[model samples]
Target: MKLSCTECGQGRSITDPVWRCECGGLLQVEQRLGELDGEKLRRVFDERLAHRNTPYASGVWRYKELIHPELPVERIVTKYEGNTGLYDSEPVRRFTGVRDLRLKAQSENPSGSFKDNGMTVAVSQGAWLGYERFACSSTGNTSSSLAMYAALSGKASYVFVPEEGVAGGKVLQTAAYGARMIRFKGTYDDGICFLERHAAELGLYVCNSMNPFRIEGQKSIVYEIAQALNWMLPDWIVLPGGALSNGSALGKGLQDMLATGLISRMPRVAVVQAEGASPFHRMIERGLKELTPEPRPHTLASALNIGNPPSWKKAAAVLQATCGVTVSVTDEEIMEAKAVIDRAGIGCEPASAASAAGLRKLVARGIVDKDETAVCLLTGHMLKDTDALQRYVTREAADAGMPVSSALELEQVKERM
Candidate 1:
C-alpha cells in the first residue's frame, strides 16, 4: 500500500508522517490486491468467523487484506470492534416506502458509535509508528471513540470540541475515558482548523477521518454490510453525511470489492445532509465543481452540524463513480425519522435518522424506487444524545403549555393505560 495525493497524484510511503499532500490535497491509501480469487476469499473470510482471537475476531480486521494489507497483525489494536447487526425493521421499511430495507446499526460497536470502526485502525497505525499521543476535533462521537481506544492502548489522548452544542452523554463518555478535553468558543470547523494548524507543534498524531488509516478502517463497514447480505450488493446504500469520511470510505471499499471480483455491481450511494449544513448537497444541486462551505451551519442533529466537511472531494468522487445522489433534510424531518426509529426499538441519534428522512424524500420523488432494496447506515446509538431525544419528546408539551408529567394515583395510571 502507498499514500497518494488525491489531486496532484504525488505518492509516498504509507509510513510517512503526513495527512495532506504538498499541493494541499488530501492523501488516500492505495492498495494493490493482485489476482484475488473472489469465491476463495469469501470462504476464507467466512471461515475466520469461528476464530475467537484478536484481529480475526474483529469485524474490521477480519477483512484485513482489503483494509490495511501491509499492516502486520501484531501492530493491530482492536476492541473487537464492528460486527454490528443489520436489522430488517418493518416500521423503517414502511416509513421509507421501500419493499426491503435494512438498518446497519453501526452504533452496536464497542464505543456506541461507528467511530470505533475507524478509531481502531487509526490508533493501531499510530502505535505502529511509535506515537504515544493522539488528538482530534469532534462534535461528540469521534472524541469518545478516540478517547476510549487511546486509553485502552495506554496512549495519551487530547480532544478539541466546540465550547457548546455537544451532547452531554458524549462529553461524559470522553471524560470517563481519560482524554484531556479542550474547548474553544467557536464551531466544529474552527476546532478542526486548530488541530490541522498545530498537530505537529503539539507532538500529537491526529486520529480524525482525515487520517487515511481511519478511512481504511471505515471501509470495513461496507465489507460487513456486503458479507451480511451473503455477498449480494444492495441497490442503494444510504447514510448520513457529516465529515463525509464514511461515504468516501464506502465508495473506495466498493471499488476494491469490484476489483477483486467479490461483487458484480456497485451499489448506488445516497448521502443525506442536514438542511442547515448541506454544502455537499448544495454542490450537487447547483452543478458546481467545488463545495462552498456554510459559514454558520445550525442543526438539531449535533453530529451533522458540520458546515465545511474536509472529505467533500473524496465523497464527490464516490458519488460520481457509483452514479449516486446527495440530498438534504430539514431538522424537523430528522427528528421525525428519529422518533420512528426509536419507536420501532431501533434507536439512533438524530443525525443517523437523516438517512431515513432522506430516503423517504428520495422515494417520494422517484429517485429511489419503492421496490428496491436499500440499507440505511445508522452512525451512532440513540443514547449518544439523550438531550436531543428529550427535546424532541417535550417540544409538543412545551409548545402547548402542558405539564410534561402530572402526579397520578395508581388507579389513574391504570385507567390511562
Candidate 2:
C-alpha cells in the first residue's frame, strides 16, 4: 500500500526515503474499502517464511500483505513486539465496576512498554529501506524501545531525552540499549518540536508517534484484541493519554479492521490524561470542535507530558468518531491506582495506572455502565520508575515499620519459617 499525505494527498513508498508530503503534512496509509478474511489471513501467517524467527506467531505479520506485500517474506524485521497477552483480572473488575474487564499488558513487551509495537515496525521498515541508523525523540519509553530494537537489527541509534526526564529507569534503559543520548534542557514536547524542525536536516528519521510507521505498528494491538476476543468489539477501551497518539492510532487501527471486515463494530474510546496536564480533557468537556491548547501542559506521567501533540488533528477525529470522553486523573489518584495495579500483580508506571484510575472514576460517576466490557491499556512497566517505586515502597514501609533488606542479602540468609 502506498502512503499518502494526511493533509495534502501526496504519496511515497519504500523507494522514497523522504517520507513527507510536499505540503509538509505527514503521510497516512492509503487504505481501500474491504474486509480481511480471518481464515485467509491465518493461512498466510502459517506459511510465512519468516515465522520461525519472529517473536509473536501473530503480529502485523498476520496481516503482512497489508503492511509490506511488496517486500520479500524474509526481509521484514520480526522481533515479536506485538501479540502481547490480555488477562482477565478480578481485581481490575472490583476496582473498575465493569463486569467484563480485560487488561492489555503491554508492559510485557520486550522494551517494557507499548511503544515497542511501533518501534519494531519502524526499524523493520527502515532496514528494508536500507537505512543503517535511526533516531527518535522520546519521553523515555520510545527511545528505549527503539534502542533495543535497533541494536537487535544491528543499526545505530540516537535518542533525545529531556534533562528532567534523565532521573528515572527509562534513562538507564536507554543507556543500556547503547543509544547515543542527547539531553535537551526542556520538556518532552519541546524536544519533539525541536526534532520536527531539525531532524530532516540531521538526516535522522523521527521514530516518535509523529511518524506514520508508528501507527502502522501500533495497529497490531487492535489486531490482537480482536483475535483474542474472537472478533468481538468491547463496549469501551480506556487508555492513558499524553500525546493522544496511541488512542488516535488505536481508532485508526479499528477503522482499518472495520474497513477490512475484520470486526463488525468499533468500541467507544475513553481518553485518560493526568490532571496536571488536562488540556485535552478540558477541550473534550467543553465539546470544542478544535483541540487547541493554551500553554504549559505538565504531568507526572512523563510519557504523556506532551502539551502540543503532533497528532492532535487525528486525535480530535478519533474522539469525535467514537464519542469518547476524556477523564483527568490526579497524581494522588494515579499513585493510588499504582497501588491497586501492584496489588493485582501487574506493576506499571503512573501513566499506565492513569487508565485504571480513569475507568474507576467513570464507573463511580455512572458515566460507564457495569455491564459494558471494558479494556484498560497498561502502557509501561512500573520498574521504569524504580526511584518513584522505591519512594512509594519506602514510605509505606516507614509507616508500617516493615523490615526492609536487599533481596540478595535476604537470600544469603535463612528465615525461621
Candidate 3:
C-alpha cells in the first residue's frame, strides 16, 4: 500500500510518517495490484474466521487484502478490535419507523467506539514505522482508543482534550490507559491545531483519522456489515458525523467493494450530525461547495461537537460518491433516540444515537422509505459518556415523551404499597 494525496497526486510509501502531502492535501491509501478477486477474497476471509487460532480472525485483518494487505501478520498489533455486534432490534425498528433495520454497534469493540477499528491499524503502522511516541486530539473516543492501542504497543501516548473537554468517563478511560493527558483551552479543533503544531517538534506520530491508515482501517466496519448480511448492500447506511472520518471511510470501502465485485449495489450513505454542530449539514442544506466551521458548536453529545472536522474533504468526497446527504437532528432528538435504544437494551452513547434520530427524521421527510433496508452505525457505548445518560435518567433533562418513573420493583418496595 502507498499513500497518495487526494488533491496533488503526491505519492509515498505507506510506511512514511506523512499525514498530508507537501501541497497540504490529505492522503489516502492507494493499492498497487491487479483486479481484486472478491469471491476468492471472501473465501479466504471466511477461512480465517473459521479458524479461531489465527490473527486473521480479527474482523479488520480478516479483510486485510483490502486493508493494508501487505502488512505482515507478526508485525500487526491487535486487541481483537472490530467484530462488533450487528443487531436487528424490533423496538429500534419501530422507534425509527424503518423496516429491515440493522444497528451496527461499534460500542462492542475493545475501546468502546468505532475509533478502535482505525486505532488498531494506525497504531500497528506506527509501531511498524518504529515510532516510540504517539498523540491525538479528541472530543473523547479517539483519545481513549489511541491511549489503549498505544499502551498495548508499549509506546508512549499523549492525548489533547478540549478545554471544555468531554465526559469524565471518557477522560478517565484515556487516563486509565496511562496516556499523558493535556488539556487545551478551546474546542476540539483548537486541540487538534495544538497537536499538529507540536507533533513534529515532540517527535510524536500523529494517529488521528487524518492519518490515511486510520481511515483505511475503519473501512472494516463497512466490510463487517456487508459480510454479516452475506455481502448484500443495504438500501441505506446511516452514521453520526463528528470528525466525519467514518463516513468517508465507508464511502471509500464501498468504492473498493464495487471494484472487487463484493456487492452489486451502492447504499445511499446518510451522515447524521447534531444541529448544534452541523456545519457539514449546513453546507449541504445551503447547496454550498465550500464548508465553513460553526463559530459556536454546541451539543450535549460532546463527541460530535467538532466545528472544524479535518476529514471534511474526504467526507464530502464520500457524499459525492454515494449520492449521500446530510441530516442534522437536535440534541433532544438524539437523547430521545438514546432513551428508546436504552429501553430496548441496545444501548449507545448520545452521539451514536444520532443515526437513529436522523433515520427517524429522514423517514418522516419521505427521504427514506419505511420498507427499505437500512443500517445505523452506532459509534460508541453508553458508558463512554455517562454524564449525558445520568442527566437523562436522573430526570434532569427529560425529553417531551419520556417516562418519569420506572415500574415498581422489589428493590424499592414502598410501605404504603
**Which candidate has the highest TM-score of all?**
1
Off by over 4 Å in 1: 396-408
Question: What lDDT would each prediction earn against the true structure?
Answer: 0.92, 0.79, 0.89
- Give the range of the ten consecutive residues with the poorest summed lDDT in model 3: 396-405
For every candidate in turn, the CA RMSD to the true structure comes to 1.6, 3.4, 2.7
Across residues 53-96, which tens digit of lDDT does each residue of candidate 2 receive?
A: 55435466666655555666576666676667698889868988
84 Cα displacement, candidate 2 (Å): 1.6
The segments of candidate 2 whose C-alpha lies over 4 angstroms from its true place after superposition are 18-24, 33-39, 42-58, 403-417
Name the 10 consecutive residues with the lowest summed lDDT in model 1. 396-405
What lDDT does model 3 reach? 0.89
RMSD of 3: 2.7
Q: Can you write out model 1's per-residue Cα lDDT over 16-82, one digit (the tens) per residue?
A: 8788998999999987765677888899899988879768999999998888878889888999999
In candidate 3, what are the lDDT values of residues 145-171, reduced to their tens digit?
999999998899999887783888999
Report how far residue 90 has shifted in candidate 2, in Å.
Answer: 0.8
Higher-lDDT candidate of 1 and 2: 1
Runs off by more than 4 Å, candidate 3 = 396-417
Q: Which of candidates 2 and 3 is the stronger one according to lDDT? A: 3
